[model samples]
Target: MPSSAAHLLSNHYNETRNEYYRQLDTASRNGGDILPFINYAVQGFVDQIRNQIKHIRTEQLRIVWINYVHSRFKTLSSRKDRRRRDLLLHISEFGLLHKNIIGVMALKIYAGKTVTTLKRDIGYLRSEELIEETLTGYFPNLKALTAFLPVQRRVVE
Candidate 1:
């Protein structure tokens, strides 16, 4: 597996772990029952983590694609701009991890990139794209990089 894939899997695992912690924190603050927390620790947490592990490969490919696109912006000079790019990557990775059709939509409503912007970034990258055909086996649509872009969001306003 590529290092990019591993990083994505790690990020997924950490997200799951952080969510679990958040649940515990919320419960503690609310003075909720301890029984459910114990059950979550013993069964829910383990089962969720196991399920995530089962689909690690799919998650890896998703992140690898994002990483490939992100690599295009490696020369960004402004810290603020780089942070925005990093946040975009993080949201994209999270949406991919959810494995849902509306994942990117959810991200957009929560302050993620518009699909057009993402596609534009991809187009920008394509002008100087360096990925070779051999990478396709590892990435579902590696030969056509834009195929990995998230679905475009329609502004309601």
Candidate 2:
């Protein structure tokens, strides 16, 4: 996990633990059966922490994919070239970018460039293995994440 994810998980865990303690104290003072409270708190904490861990994994993957794209496509010197980079980032963030969706995106981001240019950019990304051609459309090749698996394992652990 990255520093931000780790910090957030730590804060959430501490907060949940503190609340569990508070509940336990209240139950003890009131002479109530604390077993139910303990069970509920444990279950809720486990569920919330599991969700947070999944979210952290997703965020980490997105970050790694974006960084890989940036490293591969560093020469964003012209507006046209920059648009290609933007397109790649868009694909990375939101997968299944079909031709029709790309056409709409072209009108917004790749303005002034012809549809041919947009296609060419997509072709270039495919050639570089930065994006993959799926039955639905283009998607960022998350295989790039494998290269950083060691680092990811260390951080997550």
Span of ten consecutive residues with least summed lDDT in model 2: 148-157
Candidate 1, 17-97: lDDT as tens digits: 886677678789878867765665555544544566657746766667787657756777575446445534654444322
Q: Write one digit per residue (lDDT tens) for candidate 2, span 1-157.
A: 5554455534545667877677778888878978867676656655666778778788888888787777766866677667778888987767768867545444568676677888888898899788888777898888868676654333342
TM-score to native of every candidate shown: 0.27, 0.65
Model 2 score (lDDT):
0.73
What value does the lDDT take at residue 99 in candidate 2? Answer: 61
Q: For every model in order, what is the number of clashing pairs?
A: 0, 2
- The numbered model that scores best in lDDT is 2
